[model samples]
Target: MYPQVLFQNRKPDRIATLEEYRKSGGYEAITESLKNRSHKDIQEILLESDLLGRGGAAFPAGRKIMTVSDDAPYPRYVICNADEMEPGTFKDRVLIHADPHMLIEGMLIAGYAARAEKGIIFIRPEYENAARILEREIGLAEEAGFLGENILGSDYSFSIDVHRSGGRYICGEVTAQLNALEGKRPNPKQPPPYPTEKGLWGKPTVTQNVETLCCMPHILRNGAQWFKDLALTEAGAGTKIYCVSGKVNRPGCYELPMGVKLSEIIEEHAGGMKNGAEFKACLPGGASTRFLSREHYHIPMDFNSLREAGHRLGTAAIMVFDEDTCMVAATLNLLEFFARESCGWCTPCREGVPYLKDLMWRIEHGQGEEKFLSMLRKQSKYLWISYCAFAPGAMSPVEGLLNDFEDEVMAHIRQKRCPFKGGE
Candidate 1:
């Protein structure tokens, strides 16, 4: 059975109010923490829980908090990374839209643990509705003494501010986010000085994903053991918001245990493939992840498990494709997105992606031979060794397609046309 932590009192079409949320025992954990637990105690609880970052890196969240707590003198800042810019990842937007108060409570608890005096929700510009809801909800929270000065009548005071990004994919990176918050272009910088030591105007800061922060209230209320038990596998813990897209009959978000089977999610949760289309393959995570064919659907969806299966559970955005889909065309489409979004910070990503896209175009159009395939394969190696995550991530779909759908690619070469030319 799916846990109620993620969708407890969910009204799919409407957002929950503070009053409604409080009635469902929403802020009780935070209220208890403010009244009873000290900053050190909260930090200890987090460490004991072993909660990893819900964002891409999967670093231990508790250790990060402790680093900020120990390094910063007195007032640190906590930033909730709400910039859900990854193309197929929209679970964060849904969570924030559904329950704004949950996020506020979680942020408050996190701020207390990190000894932070201020918090910021760095949201994407595309999430206009989410930002509006957060702003209004935050105002309500302040009036209710949950935010702003002297929160909950405790000596620990904290404030939260909502800021919108100028619209860029790299802005999702921590360093780029810090730069954007400081009124600069969103570009990543070299790091020996991590965010914990020097961040946000040279003050210590801790950044967490929107989903990561929202999980805090439940963690505090239910205890770390309960949270750990939520995992379907040893490597992962708690419920995850799985966003299903592409050719599924019902392409939407479903909250399930961390290691739920991909087949179960596709057939049961996503309502199976559309038009009774035969399942071909899936990008188990977002576009950045490697593709997994129908044979791999039995594998569990978790951080390390997915990696062991030769893919990354990146943002848990499962994009399914049916037999009718053209593998080469699909690979080209994803490469186009990566090429366009490249920040040009590194030479490989800036040039390699576009070049790879051109190679795919030539091959897809059947204007090439074995030489083109060889060149693309060699270019992928260079991309993998690039400066940042973008170049390597950008190569995933192409490499996966080449490895898993070599026959389809060869058909394009032989026929000089896309196999599914008329949408199969």
Candidate 2:
């Protein structure tokens, strides 16, 4: 309803065909960009747009593109990171199903902006159907000359392929994804040779999230100023693909202004809390981010605004919970997933996550020691020095429990039972 550029052609019950997308001026940007704009012009326009990466980190998309030097080696790669493994995150799957060509067109333009020749959509194994749709649509795109070998009669040529991952949460990490793509054991490689400098078989590769890449085509289609004006806040640009779930009546994807308030996203768009349930808290961004208590109910849901409030809009996967939900048990549940999915590559993440999970489990089951609280706090900070961000992210809910929901946690320890569970 709010100017759905991305979902403009989203058809209910079935994916939009190439004809529908084309009719709505889908591939028009790539065509116009290739014919008139130089690669530098593309770079400048993105910078002006102030588009940040939708993938957790919120890195500047323009700056990331600029990293690939114009003089960088040929046959560079631009990987569309479709490994949407974060708990409570599934916007990528919805976006892919709604319109596959949008992704293809976005990647074609991304490949051009990043000076890349090959584009790869590195998706997780669970998304097999989406992968097949992408493959089918890609074949259609090539047949229509939107991809492969002098696209649209321009000198630039690019090809895109969908690569199914072995299906691990670790594979979503940038360096680990590159390793997985190369058939190597997926381990987080410390940077020095950043992906843009050297990646994916020792070549300059630009890897971006599916949502991040999908933004490019639209940004290019609309002028930079127009893109900047789309956000509800001065700090944000364009619309955000929010994947809202849990406790909300309408738990699905919504394309809204980047800086829409968290309250409005819930009360207005998502049909408010389920069954008139009183809102207790929410993981404002997927499971990895800290919980947003009722104190910040009206907080602006944008990267900069969230950061200013000591929070993050990581993937904007808002997982809401009603007052009847138990915070301690909720945090414990998230911790278990993080511990189980840990790659076990580094000591902090390998051992630390499970160790923290055990402490939370004991507390929830009436075996908690007050000492464990201090230990949890200590370990959460200690894990930050891990090989990658996996440990810190995994420990976020733990940190949130200790910080925001300490009273609930203490209630469990003192009562020797989960407060939310049925009384004996």
Candidate 3:
């Protein structure tokens, strides 16, 4: 177990009501921010804390706050990106469901800092309970003078709308999310005029993940140094909600410090492997991240540590695979999801993902030849030509297959069938 800043005191088997959350000293950050602090002050604190985005990319959240154009003709917008579509990623779902007001209060502080009058919670439709909880909490906040006109009798005013996503993985991408929110076809638009510059309806917008925003209130209440000291690593700040699944005795989300070792998370936190199963490899983060072998288990699970080890801390969703799991079959299963979720906007992602999936399926089913293996490897390399991160992320499992599990895949080819057939 590690620090539980996010989940501490959370009620088991029940969603935290607005009253309960408020009673627990919630909304104090936004109240202090609006009544006494300015946007620049908030931004400076965040910058000092070095809190990276909790979304897959791990970008700096404060940098996004500072870059919004206040002089833009249109009102700036803030979006709470709750589109948790990445496979094995459900921490956001838990956050929204248990402590919806945490996200709401966090958004209020974010909107205040960005000078954003309008905000949107872009929640995935699949998370019906979380969406409902958030919607109800937004109303409660409005009635309590935390949202809508003249918040806390001050000049600052902000309102939030919860929008159910159209159920595409692409919508998790900020630009594509803006497009979908604007009632356009969901697709990733090229960057340069990034969301901070020109976003929803061509207005400057700040989009942050649900967990990233949830950290805002704590940073405000505890101060930047306190937040920085909470991390176990030099650069890492705050706690990470690790969603552990697959072959683990404890298959659920655990809030751990940033630099907690992977081995601790897998063995101690996840209660070791289920039924004494030997850990073969893990996605470490979500499906998009590169796999980490048991040898890397002693390393810290921070952004820099994982990246230094040639992997990403994607959404911090740890998916462990036991020894009996077939690497080739697992790779194919992930590719099939990517192929189905492709937005079909560009040829590389639209066509390439499905083609890769087909190749992997053939190889998994024992129809693979040397050329098919070569094509799988080559296609994984070139899928980066796609419009957005989708295709490249789709190829992550393939990357793991080629790099760490090549012998496992070779066994499939040699056996002329998956070695672990009928045994995922």
TM-score for each candidate, following the candidate numbering: 0.96, 0.98, 0.98
Model 3 poorest ten-residue lDDT run: 1-10
lDDT of each residue in 161-195, candidate 3, tens digit only:
98999998999998899999989998989988888
Q: Taking the tens digit of each residue's C-alpha lDDT, what string does model 1 give over 150-179? A: 878888888999999988888888998999
Candidate 3 TM-score, true structure as reference: 0.98
Q: Write the per-residue lDDT of candidate 2 for residues 398-420, one digit (tens) a residue.
A: 87778888998899999999888
Count of clashes, each model:
0, 0, 0
| Model 3 steric clash total | 0
lDDT of 1 at 224: 83
RMSD of 3: 1.1
Off by over 4 Å in 3: none
Q: Each prediction's Cα RMSD?
A: 1.5, 1.4, 1.1
User: What lDDT does the true structure give each of the candidates?
Assistant: 0.86, 0.90, 0.88
Candidate 1 local Cα displacement, residue 54, angstroms: 2.0
Give the deviation of candidate 1 from the true structure as CA RMSD. Answer: 1.5
**After aligning candidate 1 to the native by TM-score, how far in Å is the CA of 13 from where it should be?**
2.3
